[model samples]
Target: TGESDATVTNVIVASHYMNYGGYDNLKIASSTPYPAIGIKMGVCEGDSTLISILNKGMDAISQKEKSDIMNKWITVQYEHGVDMKKVSRIAIISASVVLFIFGSFYYWNRKLKKEVSRRKEAEDQLRNSFDEITEQKKIIEHKSEEVMDSIKYAKRLQEAILPPTSLIDEKIEKNFVLYLPKDIVAGDFYWMESTVCKESNNELNFIAAADCTGHGVPGAMVSVVCSNALNQAVLQHKLCEPGEILDKTTDLVVERFERSKEEVKDGMDIGMVSIEKISDTQSKIKFAGAHNNLWVISERDDIGATSNKYELESVSKSLFEIKANKQPVGKYEMRKPFVTTELLLEKGERLYLYSDGYADQFGGENGKKFKTKNFKNLILNSIDKDLNAQKEVLLTNFNDWKGSYEQLDDVCVIGIEI
Candidate 1:
């Protein structure tokens, strides 16, 4: 390092730091003893306040930490080899030393000025470069916002396509749709349609909760496709059975996506239910699903239905979970026909169709998923309350379960009183 130091003529850069290291002796004369280096931090005569503040800050550090830092620089075997008298004489001739120190400081200041000038020029160039970068960043951000705006407009269109609130309220006497999108738009969608069977002239109320393969834009696109397929199956094809609609929807979605040259495998999992009122007090319900399940909650009390929510809250309720087909709506290796399960339900029973979003959400005290079993329990517990109160309780429980965690997926829960 000394050889490297000797190679350079003016070593101002090393002058600041070289003194921090312990050395045997500092020799600046022609007859030298060792390398010459020194480092000292000081304030001017009028800077008592600055020194006091610095000391106060330094006092916060532990004594051991400060000692360790000091010992690293001041070696245990350090010997300046100068007595007090000589140093006192050097102080007595303070005027001459001050002149020399001032001259050296002036020389260093000149060097510092040249450095500052060079750095100023570099900073000007860097500032220009940063300005260009900032401008480009702003442009990129604007374009991104515009893209998001377009997507938001697309979300509005998607919202329009969903089963209207009026329609659901009209078809089902008491219903609650708990729909939450992970983003501005969602892949999980709920749809309901009221139709009359051509054969028997019976009114069929069809409802479905579907979860697409993805979320956000891509999933929403697939949802749109699947929803259209459902529409075609009911309105165009006149197919009312849950199984028939599922079959037609799967076919249409697969056909549409496969139309592209790249083999696309986009699909969805759906739980569909068709309800037809057989009598004033009874109804026939057909259910089908693809990787989704259906839940039915019996009335808390069959006694005279009360208008108040708290009146029925104390009554006990039971839940029934029906498993679905293992296959998805899209292409699968072992594809089988979607089977429809037919059931008869009494008045005051509630039917629940939902995506896996709620159950699969990651949250809780231990940060675990709210699995399907627990979700069924939640539905069963809330079944005693009125439909609107049930919605409030479910959302409150979900929020409590999901403390500060993000919603993992799109959630859609549809409950209808039979």
Candidate 2:
């Protein structure tokens, strides 16, 4: 290593210099002939006082104290050999701990990813189901609209079949018809036909309030059949008597039903009247009913004096009821000839012909049927009013009694003032 140099010089340094490494190749030529220098203290150039004090303090220290201090600072303690086994064990344990932590993190991250994928799949399935439901709902709504359109067209046809108000007004001078159907089409109908009597040559107006078997479409169909039967009895057969007309009507209805293979038992409940004007203040009335009645209110005080031919139910001095046969106009085991009741009504008499819908309605304080007794009272109380005003009274009382309940059936009420 000294081949590059021409001359080699040796220098003596502090004893602490031997504590460091990289000096093994240097040789101590003569430790006893080494040059020596005295230890000196340093201070600022202008601070001679601090230098003097430090000199005094150093001089005051004993030689044994100085030697002990120097030995304490310079001494070094060193272990003889390294423990390779303990170092190797600590390194293995640390590596194992770090590996375990990273492995647990990786396992949990994979599990979380799988769970997220499963939730996304379920959400997609639910969205598809919702879309299918929405499409089905649209189809159902379209079908419902078609059905409602058909029903509305049927309603118009039904209305066209009913007798107009002007026709009724022309037939009866002072009359009011309160016709209310539970649905758009009704089972209840009011019919009137004017015909000339063959014997007396006087005009006879046949008026009726009839309730068919059911309500809505089925009832409306049956009503058409029954109404046609009445028309045949009056116009085709030339029947003027109420009882004879009903008899012919029942026969025609039964015959029509017999034509059907299935045993058809549908029929109507009717209150029919044939009115003929006799003089300026007198009129002749023939009444016949099938499960319906006629109410006559008069202030004349001789309610049953003129009509002794048939039994009369005298509810009050002014109100009188002519009861119908208990059986319906349709096929029945105990069917008999419908009785005709004849009455001569004078001026200021009120006549009422109605279906059972008014009295059969369900509502009130206890949600009970508006019984016949209450119906009689209502008509009797409103007898003083004109036919139109009395119609309003009847409608008001009916709605009040019905309250929030649904209407039970079709209502047809005809009030006539003579």
Candidate 3:
């Protein structure tokens, strides 16, 4: 076979023939300068090459361009929804101003209301407190008046029960009585009566001072009962001796109350004396007491003066051992029977009788008591003074010692000079 250059040339001739026919026909039909196939074929192959080049040149682009693209995508949707810069700023400013005004007004209004409420509560509390205090004051005044009235009535009764001062004076040469009450009605009472003793062939004159169990109304009532019983014992019962008198009074008091009733322990502490004068220099004294004793003040001539000045009168200590009845004039379960004592008084001797009240009373700057020792000293110091002046001295001393404190007990003192 021959080298076939003829066959290759024939094939080329057929491709050129096809191209020319299509190209000429499209040119003629479209009336464009180039065939559509030419442009399409060139573009498809060139676009693929351009895409590969763009991917390779990515690192060469500026950062601004990359950032702009990213921001554009994020804000793209909100841009059309609102005009944020202009309209939003106006709305926010208006709302904040309205809220500030409302909050300030509300705070001031609440503060004013709280102040008004607090003032009203204070006024109400003050009014209620004043009312309570007024009511209590009225109650106290009423109670005080009642106590005073009771005391006044009891005092009158006590005065009527006591005998005249003349009766006591007739028995002793010179005498004095000092009586003080803790309240309006005293717990202590004094008595005087006349009697005759057949055994010693003597006409006896007697005086008595006594302290009842309690003070105030309770004590006053007991005093009334005791006073009545004592009179009856002397006059009606005819019990002359002090011991017999006390025994009779005790039986009467016990019998006055019922057996089934609640028992009351109310009785008296007493100092009783019978005085009779034989001459100007000689006299007789008989005494009895319940848990109490007496003292004697006498002038001694044995002591002399020094430096031409009269010596101070000596103060001697002597106890009047009155036979005390072991028993109280009441139905006490634990009481011993009373006993009587008799004594004869010489000239220039004095006898004293007193109750525990004055000694027990609280006084002094330190709130201490005007005790027995001080009382004795006072009596001795005032030996030259008259009975009335001596009494005044005692009262002054008591008041001075008492200072500003209230009297705690009733006070009583009796003195007799033979």
Candidate 4:
């Protein structure tokens, strides 16, 4: 009866904590109990394990003793046992949660650092690419400018080979040269000279116009070669017949270009006319043309006694039937011979020889060609006008017909009066 109660679970054990005085008070309550057997005893109070045992034990006790012992003992025991374990588990879970939060923050911080470094690398690569593109653009611009300057200088060199105004003036006595270049250089060239044939000692005067293959720089280069050949033929080689001169000139061009292994098919379509003034009444004439013609105008006297309107007479005819040598001055061998023809000129006669430039010029509002027939008409139309006036009118008509169209080819015209 004097033994002390110890705690059975980790909960407040009131029996263990109470002073000796508390037990004495509990003794007085127990001593003064009523007459009933349950009333005579104090209510049972214990730790969770003890309360459960007491609850089971109370079933064996009388019904009169059940209520007081079960309510008090069971509640106290549950609080000390299951409830205390719940508190301990809660504390452990809260510590785990804190650790999880710190771990997430650490992982995200490392991810952010990696992303920042990648962004910096990408930006640097982009900047380098942009700088390279800018430098390349500058290089391309410089190269383009150099190419344009080279083309401009090439144009100047090609022009130097053309016959100057002073040179043409010396040969024709009085003449007008309408020279137009298609590009910066010309593929058409004209030449003239006054001399006596050495073999016959006859006063000989001649003019020639030529159209080379192609039209721009390549054509201009060919023209230079051809021009040198013609100059050598007349001045150095002293060739007599026009056909013989052309044949010899072809041989020279072939020899000059042989090293390049290039085909010598390149040559000029040329027209030449020779005038030998014998007397005031008449003159001996010899003309040759390759795919072109010569026109002459003469005044005819009517001896009839009736008054009549005077008509300007056209004496233009082919110096020879226009034909090719059946071969070009090239690697290909030619067995055929070039043809040449001669004609006589009467007094007060004017003749014209020209390149295809004038007839082939594309003009008019519709950009149509000034055809050969129209060219013939134009020549006949100006037969009555003075030579200078005729040239002026011809230029005026061309400009008027051309309108806004650019000249498609170089134009050259040569007229001679005997």
Candidate 5:
């Protein structure tokens, strides 16, 4: 709060944020409270290797080394949070067991082919082996149950972090949030909040669809950090500008991740928006994205984008595209400020913010991915439907396309009718 409120832009904040290659505005106020003193990396007590690594890292650092490392990066090893070696060992064991189990099926097939005269005895032996198979099945089922229970708990925690459904319903008159996770949990998340603009005394609705790096557990962790950053920018700093909010979020997220000892390239791609009613005929839409784009759909009865104002029908769908800055919300070798786009929408037009999961789904007869082109066509086919119905249509289409294949990633899409 103080950082945003400072009249003098030149100020001191802890230098941890600088490690992620952002927050250049704030300098360190003092040296005693290093980045480690304020931020923390949680680890399991049973993990001795990680604890030893931390001890060695701290002890190895000298004043000169601290200056060198502090000037460049903050350090905390992420392996303390999750042990990859144990997971890999478990995976290898599971694969070996599966192969052994399936090999029995092959063995039974060969015995049936080679020993028809002894079929009765072979059948007896196979039936007895089936008991063992059933035992393995029971064990697998028990383990699966435990895994699912933990995932369900994780799902609840993830849901609690999201904005309340009541708040969304109260603020947004016409909208639908389509969220689907490949697993019980997801990396894709949507953020929505409504605030009354003090200067204009108009209600402004803020919304974003973000796709965090990775999926499942890793992605979920990053989403929590990114989501908190968004909340801090909007709720704490009282920021409303789409570009400004994104910029602030970038700095915060970058700084947050920089506290790690490893080079954490993890980040999120977001399509953020601010919608305000300009008049009955028009509304102002401000959008900014980090490697994601906004789609504005226009109907003939409502408002349509004229070629004079916007490049009309650039997409095969019934919408015009507002391209995002071709950069992510984290450090890049080539840095560029996030670009913002503005549009005036008629009362009938609709806006869309989405993560890539929908388009990147692997499905269809050829077992191919449902690429962006097909996704656009599906949107165009369902153009006349209400936002809620559109969601159902999309899901149905996705299911039809997927057939027997599993979902590839977490999907999140948000639509609002202006």
Candidate 6:
């Protein structure tokens, strides 16, 4: 093929020519047998002498020589060669591809396993936190129940110390007490006691409306101390005059508080009245107060003429106010003896003694205080009604004024008709 100066050539050749003895220098790409021919030679039809000469030469060749020629030309030999460097390169590349696939799979599997573990841990922590919160809620509810129970028991004790309704009804024929506590136990209380005067032998009924320093438990405790002091002053000391009784009461309360090592600054604001009936049409009243007031409603022209200390405001024609001292019934920087106010009460007149809770309540459309002025107007309008009806009217007005607002403090109002 190189002798023809051809770079590449394809030709149909005899199968015998592919071996080493025939065309040994040529690289035979492929070979196929020609089935139509064996060992035949072609010649011209007019070449009789050449044909006779080729036939005679072929007959002269020996069998051994022909066998050797056939063996040399037709026998197969190893010709195709292998490239070791290319085979090694293919082997390394295939190994590297398999290793990469396995490595990626391993990395993803480990990542998925870690994610599942983290989620499980988070779920466990959440469950633990929920359990702790539920336990704390239960504890808080139990403590609250205990506190409520104690407050209810304290209410019972507080009720025991107050004057019974039956006693008030028996002593004062026409009377109504409006008592409302902001909490379970209130600091506001109404008290009454009956005693006969030593000199005049006149029957005296002493009644009081008191408001302590605060409301609820602390106020109730102070009320207990103060109520005991009042009882001691009236029963033990035999004090009849309203001013003397308050003076003795202040001494007793101060002495009782002094026994405590800690400084006790609790006290009460009280309005007390002692009523003595003289006749069917007339009665006498002596009142004393500490930061509380007495209100007398009458149709008589001389309502405040008997008492020099009474105030008659033009806002209400039938209302008279006996203002209390500007100090409480406890420790004060400018303490003085409480004043006793004397007045004459007719058969059809009414008396009101109360704490500041009613006037101090915050409500109405403007969410303002039910001020003293408005309270006086309400009382003046309701003066013509009976004691029971007046109580109902007061209650209704208080509720209406309060509306959705919470009661500010303990409220106590006492009314009496002579």
lDDT of 3 at 120: 82
**Order of the predicted models by lDDT, top scorer first:** 6, 2, 1, 5, 3, 4
Which pairs, if any, clash in model 1? none
**TM values, all candidates:** 0.71, 0.71, 0.67, 0.57, 0.62, 0.72
Candidate whose TM-score is highest: 6
Scanning candidate 6 in windows of ten residues, the lowest lDDT window is: 5-14
Off by over 4 Å in 6: 1-119, 304-317
lDDT of 2: 0.82
| lDDT (Cα, tens digit) per residue for candidate 5, span 249-319 | 88998898899998887889999999889898788888899988888876543233222122225443355
Clashes of 6: 0
Across residues 70-130, which tens digit of lDDT does each residue of candidate 6 receive? Answer: 6765555434446578888988898898888888889888988898898889889989988
Give one digit per residue, the lDDT tens place, for model 3 in 184-232: 7877888777777767667777777888889877887888888888889
Q: Report residue 277 deviation for candidate 3 (angstroms).
A: 3.2
Best model number under lDDT: 6
Whole-model lDDT, model 5: 0.79
Each candidate: RMSD: 27.2, 11.3, 18.5, 12.5, 49.6, 11.6
Query: If both were scored by TM-score, which would come out higher, candidate 1 or candidate 6?
Result: 6
Residue 408 lDDT, candidate 5, scale 0-100: 89
Worst lDDT run of 10 residues, candidate 2, spans: 5-14
CA displacement after TM-score superposition, residue 272 of candidate 1 (Å): 0.3
The TM-score of candidate 1 is 0.71
Error of 4 at 237 (Å): 2.1
lDDT of 3: 0.69
Compared with the true structure, all predictions reach lDDT values of 0.82, 0.82, 0.69, 0.64, 0.79, 0.84
Query: What's the best-to-worst order under TM-score?
Result: 6, 2, 1, 3, 5, 4
lDDT of 3 at 65: 72
